[model samples]
Target: MASQNRPLSPHLQVYKPQLTSVMSIMHRATGIALAVGTLLLVFWLIAAATGERTFGDIQAFNASLIGKLLLFGWSFALFYHLCNGIRHLFWDAGKGFGLEAAYRNGRLVVVASIALTVLSWVWGYASMGAL
Candidate 1:
């Protein structure tokens, strides 16, 4: 039989998602994505060291539509993680703990991440003469 005097734990179904909670979850997810994306970096480096044929093959694949999409996703994850990490540093310094402050900072992180990602891709393409 359930105890009538004990307090019940809050269930996720009954909780309304807030920006702080959503950002916390996203921070964890982006961290994992960054780790997986590092493998692609390692592969590119190994291909370059092996020989021209191997490097060329990797380049060709990376230039494809799907590969571009993956690259964009990786870049976005990188920027998001970077921005959120900065927010964490502010928290470590004992700041921005207010509810409104947290929400505002969360929004800033999202905007900064998107802006940084777009700027990075634009610069990359421009340097490659694609822009």
Candidate 2:
């Protein structure tokens, strides 16, 4: 009897990351981030219902630098998830199946998400007179 070495499957280290794969991974990640961000939304709502003091405390925290950063990240994740989800809808409709179209739409999703996120933040700050 004899044992033989066998070839193993290619993995992260063996293969370079591609745009499609990276976008797919990011879609799942942003989905999870949105779910977590929803919890913060619920907390804020509850604080509002509880009392002015509690709501004010929440507002104060949200006005802080760290809180602002988290909100910014959550907003970006929301936009990214939304744009990627729309891309998935097109895929489900049997569109953008070609490699070139897939690549083009993938870039479109990234650009649109970033643009929307920036625009929303700018609008928010402007409305609040913080800009």
Candidate 3:
């Protein structure tokens, strides 16, 4: 008979999404974000190496509200990717593979990323005499 009595293994919708899953996906997404954001970093470095006018222009753009917002997002993404990367390294070393461990580590990464981002921005603003 060609009738199916049961579904096959590894069905895509079998498992519902969770915070840990969402964080994992976001981690990867932020990785791409940071990679793309690096174009500006490269430009900044090159401009610095070139001349004051070029560097001043770069700084001006980066100091604008929209530019600050973009860089803020970039900073968050960078920290998120970094924290998640460290978590992955633990996995690579055969740690935090259990479900409970995975969940905890995922939370740790997200929290640590947010904390780091806030700290960085705080320091940046302080240096700018804004705080």
Candidate 4:
């Protein structure tokens, strides 16, 4: 029989949030966001094939404030996912195992993802003559 006074395992409340833990959680969240974003992409493609009215409606929505916000968020998620996936690849190859190295890489992932997203959006707008 187990002791009633003692818990079987440490609960989440007992632990402080660390960079690795936060990054891991974000990695999973971005993955889910990417799936949802992919659905949006599919919807756009379907609208394109459906008719001009349908496609125009989709385009109009994409040009709206809320839609742009969602698209920006999705782009961030995409870049974040890509950066973190690369970090995982490095880990799988037995690199960045130290605590300091892990933290450094985690910070790099965040910075790189943000930079890439912003650069892509800027380039996109400039190409579209919207800049």
Candidate 5:
């Protein structure tokens, strides 16, 4: 066959990122993060059931700086996934279909997720007398 130069198909570099698209990608990522976070929860639970020594070790690690950072990330992921899930429900209900509405809802999901995560951490710390 004779070589004929044809235009390449559009790829990631060809498209500009939009708010809705970014949020959609984040939704999947946060979902994965939540799954991993659940594993941590199960580990903690098993440790608690096993004995004091195992539980104490888990607690100690959980109280460490790195652990706290991971917990913070996991909490944020949880809230983000939750808010995005609700947004998805709205889409399922045939709402937020317009571009403007999609952008608006995307912004709302981002703001609500951050607010909820912060509030939850604050409440948790206060309840623990660590605030």
Candidate 6:
């Protein structure tokens, strides 16, 4: 009876985030973000195909503060997915399997994702002259 309801095993108090754990959770998170972000892409594409009126509506919405915030998140998610995907490619090649290497590469993915997102936004705004 005493052992019937014993607390299973290690608890949350013992859980420290490791690189693999972080990556695992982030991979799922980015997957969800990517899926949600696709709606924006689809909207843009449909607007483009349907002509200016529809596109203008989309543009108006996109220009709104909330829309801009969503777009920023979408952009970041895109870059994050891309960076992590590259990390996965390296893993497929049997590299960066060690804990320290995984942590290093995980950080690299985060830094690269942010950098690429900012750089992309800057260049895009510059090219379009519409910021």
TM-score of each: 0.89, 0.90, 0.86, 0.89, 0.89, 0.82
In order, the Cα lDDT scores of the candidates are 0.94, 0.93, 0.90, 0.94, 0.90, 0.88
Displacement of the residue 45 alpha carbon in candidate 3, Å:
1.0
- Residue 93, model 3: lDDT of 99
**Candidate 1 Cα outliers beyond 4 Å, as residue runs:** 1-10
Q: In angstroms, what RMSD does candidate 1 have relative to the true structure? A: 3.6
Model 1 lDDT per residue over 9-102, tens place: 8665787998898899899999999999999999999999999999999999889999999999999999999999999999999999799999
Residues 20-93, candidate 5, lDDT per residue (tens digit)?
87788899999998898998899999999999999999999889999999999999999999998998998999
What is the TM-score of candidate 4?
Answer: 0.89
TM-score of 6: 0.82
Regions of candidate 2 where Cα sits further than 4 Å from its true position = 1-10
**RMSD after Cα superposition, model 2:** 3.7
Error of model 5, residue 53, in angstroms: 1.4
User: How well does candidate 3 match the true structure in TM-score terms?
Assistant: 0.86
Against the true structure, what is every candidate's RMSD? Answer: 3.6, 3.7, 4.6, 2.9, 3.5, 3.7
Local accuracy of candidate 2 as per-residue lDDT tens digits, 1-131: 23355555656677689999899989999999999999889999999999999999999989999999999999999999999999999999999979999999999999999999999999999999999
Clashing residue pairs found in predicted model 5:
none
Q: Write the per-residue lDDT of candidate 3 for residues 1-131, one digit (tens) a residue.
A: 55576767766486798887778788879988988998999999999999999999999999999999999999999998888889989999999999999988888888899999999999998998998
